[model samples]
Target: MERTGTEPVTARSALGLRLVLAAVYTPLFVLGAVVFSLWAASAGPGSVPSGDGLAVVAGVCAALAVLAAVDLVVVVRRRRRERGGRG
Candidate 1:
């Protein structure tokens, strides 16, 4: 479907906002993964089963990072297509 008048602008702006949020979250998620990985690695094998917990945290962070990256890519592609259409 084609966007009419201001609708395209609004949709583009929304995508830009989402891209910004994704950019902000990507680093945070990466940092969380790094921290969790370190904590998991440092934990003693015999120590309380915290490794599993840390692993879960790291996994979640990794997933978030992947999702954010995907979102960024999609938004950028959409913006490119929009711009290309206008030219």
Candidate 2:
């Protein structure tokens, strides 16, 4: 195909890539938060000394996961709009 300036150039979609990454990592983050929360909850008087630090970890992980999920949703919506809202 001869190069023509009139042709629409289709570049690789970084937004799509970001969406995939966010979607994939969101669940992992959520899982980590859940596991850490469970671990913090399981601490007993006879068990290792309880620390508020563990709960902090869980909260941070959960917050990051939610942000990632929101990012994924935003990217998906933007991509759809770029595609003329076909989706």
TM-score of each: 0.77, 0.74
In candidate 1, what are the lDDT values of residues 20-55, reduced to their tens digit? 998899899999999998989998887675888888
List candidate 1 stretches off by more than 4 Å: 1-13, 45-49, 85-87
Candidate no. 1 TM-score: 0.77
lDDT of 2 by residue, 5-80 (tens): 6655773558968988998999999998998899889876555646466778889999999999999888988888
Worst 10 residues of 2 by lDDT: 44-53
Q: Would you list the clashing residue pairs of candidate 1? A: none
lDDT of each: 0.84, 0.83
RMSD of each: 4.0, 5.7
Query: Model 2: which residue pairs collide?
Result: none
Kindly give the stretch of ten consecutive residues in candidate 1 with the minimal lDDT sum.
4-13
lDDT of 2 at 4: 54
